[model samples]
Target: MRLLLVEDDTRLAEFLAQGLAEAGFVVDTVAEAGDAEAALDTVPYDLLILDLGLPDGDGMDLLARLRARGEMLPILVLTARGALADRVSGLNRGADDYVLKPCATEELVARAKALLRRPGGALGAVLILGNLRFDTLAMECAMENRPLDLSRRELAVLETLLRRAGRVVPKRVLEEKVYGFDDSVASNSIEVHISRLRRKLEAEGATVRVHTLRGIGYMLSEEK
Candidate 1:
């Protein structure tokens, strides 16, 4: 999944972005509301983590503006404001959830995952296909109840394919999901990960298969 983090605090932004990336998300961070709004206009992010205070404007206005424009992407507010009224105000402005600052990255990641599981979101806590079972939160995968060992990148690739099970996922979309914007990637990197994933699944006797559509993308489906 891709995430946009709108935070002015450099250290906190780095910490959260690193944590979210480790948890299989591609995160882009912007320090001000203008940059954040620009980023939002271009990227189709799965979630947004916003800080309440910005150098140029209040986060409330940004939240309200997005909601008013019918932007339904899940928004999570991460701020130091813990007052009852502040929380209520955030919810009223269309923030899906609120998290106080000085929080553990683990807790923040967990909360973000929960919001992604809401109705209309692309994620499920656990994704299943044939004999394959993947727990996105735990980052675990199993085939027929036996653990399927995979590298983090491989796991991410599999997760994307599983989520869109029968539909073709474009190669460009896969690249965006598996890598952050700043990361330099080789042209064939996605293919390498897909190749490794296919071998692992075949070796494990999984009933699901990943089919490649040359010049287009890939799809995951159960063998007939």
Candidate 2:
């Protein structure tokens, strides 16, 4: 899943970004509310981790503005403000969840996954198609109950294809979800990932197929 983290503390941002990356999320971080807004305008982020104390403006205003504009993506507020009213206010202002500073990286990852499990979020506990079962929480995939060994990029490509099974997912959309701003992507990167994924599934005798449309995109569906 793609996530946008709005934080100002340099050390903390780096720490959180590392942790989130380990959990299979494509994280793009911005230190100021203005930059955050700009990133939001261009990227279709799956989640937003906002800090209430932004350098340019209040994160609360950004939250409210997103809701006013009908941006329904999940938002998790991470801040140092820990009080009854502060928590309540964050929730009332459209934050899906709130986490105080000094939080454990493990706890933050768990909470983020919980939000993703909710309706309209990008994740589910497990995604299943035919004999292929993907445990999203464990970040593992199996076919016919046998474990499937896949690299990080291959796993991400498989997940995206599985999520949009039976539909043509544009190549551009796949690129956005699998890569962050900091990562250098090659022109044929997405094609390479998908090609590897297709081979793996076919080799495993999977009942599903990954089809490529020339100059269009890719699709996954059960073989008839």
Q: For all the candidates, what are their Cα RMSDs to the real structure?
A: 1.4, 1.1
lDDT of 2 at 193: 91
Which residue pairs come into collision in candidate 2? none
Where does the lowest 10-residue lDDT sum fall in candidate 2? Answer: 149-158
Model 1 regions lying over 4 Å from their true place: none
lDDT of 2: 0.92
Residue-pair clashes per prediction, in order, are 0, 0
Best by TM-score: 2
TM-score of candidate 2 relative to the true fold:
0.96
lDDT of 1 at 14: 95
- Candidate 2 residue-wise lDDT, 38-84, digit = tens: 99999999899999998789999999999999999999999999999
| Top-lDDT structure, candidate number | 2
User: What is the C-alpha RMSD, rounded to one decimal, of candidate 1?
Assistant: 1.4
Q: TM-score for each prediction?
A: 0.94, 0.96
